[model samples]
Target: MKKMMQRDSTWAGIFLLPNLICFLLFVLIPIVSAFVLSFMQWDMLSTPKFIGFDNYIRLFTQDEIFIQVLVNTLIFTACSVPMVIIASLLIAMALNQQILGKKFYRVLIFLPVISSNVVVSVMWKWLLVPDYGFVNYFLSWFGIAGPNWLTDANWSMFSIIFVFVWKNIGYYMLIFLAGLQGIPNSYYEAVEMDGGNAWHKFRNITIPLLSPTTFFVTVMVVIGSFQVFDIVMLMTEGGPGRSTSVMVHYLYQQAFRYFDMGYATAISYILFIIVLILTFLQFRFNKSENWSS
Candidate 1:
């Protein structure tokens, strides 16, 4: 038995070895290096010098732009996350119903999710151009001139939020669709026998059962909102003077554009810590809800 167990362990390790090596090389090692580098000041061309907590101090206390970036990130999260959740949930519910061309609608909604974010952003950038763009041109039919979507600071962030929600709704819709489909029809029949109507069926059966999926989707949307960068980069490049500049985009600017590797790494860790705390709090809420129910 011991010899057989040892042989099984050996086979398991052989199967895991390739993935383990890749994780260490690509994920674990880079994470550790980033953590260490967060404590040092380096511009990639110079020797790294240990600076302890100065990077963090400068971030919170001394850096004015960092404060704006943080606020922008929060605003983006606040606006985009809820919009994505509500719109996707409603659309998912609609798509879940038995309707003509439901399959075609599902495919249409999901097409954007599978497409490249870069290409989508580029296409949106052209479409949203204030002058001679399709969006503004359409608005002109009603004698309304559209605001400068990317160049106006007031509208830039809104444009980002709108585009982000539009691009991401499909992915969340699929998740909700699966959750809806997983719910058995027997529950609805029971509700019907009890003289409950559509609202009662939805409230009593669908909502309660779909709580887990909703919770999961909420958490994912929050994390994705915080980590968003590519769309912001391609759409506005954090332009209109840092109005739509989120943490990750600013971190990229700091690390690669300005060569402030240490500062960027520190920002990255801060982002990680923020995300970690949010995730923990979400889990705590879910646990409490479960216990209460």
Candidate 2:
């Protein structure tokens, strides 16, 4: 019996060894390296100099562009996260019903979620071109002038937010659908027996039961919105004079364009801290809510 137990333990360690090694090499090491890099002044070509908190201080005090980028990222998160959650929840509820062609509708909605971000950004850029693009041209037919989407300062961020929310809705909708399906039908039946209407079922039962899924989606959407870069980079390149500049794009500029690796890493750590705090708050609130309920 002892020999067989020892054999099983050996096999378990053997199986876990490769994954453990890979995690250390790829994840843990890189994170530590980046943290060390954040405190140094290195321009890739030069020897790194220990700078302590100067890079972080400069981000808050000296770099005005960083402040704007921070605002842009916050705005993107605030707008896109709620829109994605609400829109996806509504779609999920509708699709959860026994409607005709529901499977096809689900497939159609999910198509954009699986599509390449690069391809979508380029396609939308072409479609939104001011003078000769499909969107503006269609608007012209209705006597409505379409604004220059990628170029106009006011519209550029809005365009990115709209696209981000649209692409993400389908993914969150599926998650919500899973949550909705998990909710026992017996609960709804009991509600009906008590003379509760559709609104009552949704308000009293569905909302509370779906809280976990909603919290997950909210955290993910907030993080994803904060880290949005590819589409913004491809579409507007954080251009039209910083109207659509987000943190990651600005970090990319600092790292690659200027070779300020240390400054860029500092920005990355700041972002990490912000996300960590937000996630911690979410977990705390969720625990409290669950306990109270």
Q: What TM-score would each prediction reach against the true structure?
A: 0.97, 0.97
Candidate 1 lDDT: 0.95
**Predicted candidate 1 versus true structure: per-residue lDDT over 38-78, tens digit per residue:** 99999999999999999999999999999999999999999
Local distance difference test, each candidate? 0.95, 0.95
Off by more than 4 A, model 2: none
Model 1 C-alpha RMSD vs. true structure (Å) is 1.1
Tell me the TM-score of model 1.
Answer: 0.97
Clashes of 1: 0
lDDT of 2 by residue, 84-139 (tens): 99999999999999999999999999999999999889989999999899999999
Off by over 4 Å in 1: none
Residue 179, model 1: Cα distance from true site in angstroms: 0.3
Query: In candidate 2, which residue pairs get closer than 3 Å at backbone N, Cα or C atoms, i.e. clash?
Result: none
Question: Model 1, residue 251: displacement in angstroms?
Answer: 0.3
